[model samples]
Target: MDLRQLSPTLAVSPQILPDEVPALAAAGFKVLVNNRPDEEIGAEIDHEVMAQAAASAGMGYHYLPFHPGQVTPQLITDFIAATTGRGPVIAYCRSGHRCTVLWALSQAGKRPEPEILEVAAGAGYDLTPVRPLIASLASRRG
Candidate 1:
């Protein structure tokens, strides 16, 4: 599991199998978010399967799928709602790129761009492409 810590309570990864759920729970992740839609890779990792695994591990599971260049404000809002105060969350996508991008965009004014980019870079994700969007949304923060 190529886990990358995005925050003290948040982590992102590429893809995960159902068998990894128990270890994830043991690692202290209380929530699992599927940013990848089922259509992306067919029925490879069904939501129900992940949900069942998460439940068996005593964790919460949320499926919020989005494609590249499709990370909307509403999605970010949903993510914020699903993850707030939920403890460590493990969000995954194809290569963890979409997950990381949406995470940084979700930060907006909540965190400085430099901080967001720095954290993402540490996780091996480049946020330069969405730098403009991050700046735009960040400005909307009050």
Candidate 2:
């Protein structure tokens, strides 16, 4: 998969399959966060399959389906808690958009505006549309 590093702790990629787990493990990603809803994709890439694969590979897994306008504080909290101490986390969705949004929100206060923007851009995710929200999140941390 084409995985892009958003930070030392986080990476983003398109939807990943069971076969890709070895490569992910080899790449040093200790956690796999699935942001795609199961129904959106076919059965092949459902949460259960990915979760089994991740578990088999001895990696931590979290299924946090991020539907547009459905991402809540609880989801973010769960995502953060699941990713905590899980170094080199990799989050994936259809086009990596959901994963990008989750990562941005997760970094709300821990990272600066410019740094967050730069990191998102570097990962090929343009956060211009959500700049205001990002700014608000960053300010909240201050």
Candidate 3:
């Protein structure tokens, strides 16, 4: 897994395999968030498979799948729900971009947009396309 820490509590990664869960758990990740849609991959690495791995490893698992363009307010809300207070979370998608984007959107009101972008950039994701959406979300926070 190419894990990239976004914050003390959250990290983003490229799609993780079922066999990788135990090692991730051993490495201190308390939650496994699968952001990649099942339709995008085979059953070998689908959410159910990953969920079972996470369960056996005693880690929390959340399967919130969505395409990058399909992200909605409710999705961001759910992302926040799954991530907040969940010890250390490792969210994954195909290239880690979708998961990183979800994390950035979830931070819209809670953090400054520039900081979010910088954090994502440091982790190797470019959030330029979602810049306007981040601003919009932040504006609606009040």
Candidate 2 regions exceeding 4 Å error are none
RMSD to truth, every model: 1.1, 1.3, 0.8
Give the worst 10-residue stretch by lDDT in candidate 1. 39-48
Please give the lDDT score at residue 40 for candidate 3: 96
Is 1 or 2 the stronger prediction by TM-score? 1
Q: How much is 62 displaced in model 2, in angstroms?
A: 0.4
Per-residue lDDT tens digits of candidate 1, residues 1-142?
9999898888999988999999999999999998888877756487878889999999999999887778887899888877779999999989998888888988889988999999999999999999999999988884
Candidate 3, which ten residues in sequence have the lowest lDDT sum?
66-75
Highest-TM-score candidate: 3
Task: Flag the better candidate by lDDT, 1 or 2.
Answer: 1
Comparing candidate 2 with candidate 3, which one achieves the higher TM-score? 3
Question: TM-score for model 3?
Answer: 0.97
Off by over 4 Å in 1: none
Candidate 3 lDDT score at position 41: 98
Point out the worst 10-residue segment of candidate 2 by lDDT: 133-142
Q: Candidate 3: where are CA atoms >4 Å away?
A: none
Clashes of 3: 0
Local error of candidate 1 at 42, Å?
3.3
TM-scores of the models, in the order given:
0.95, 0.93, 0.97
Q: How much is 1 displaced in model 2, in angstroms?
A: 0.8
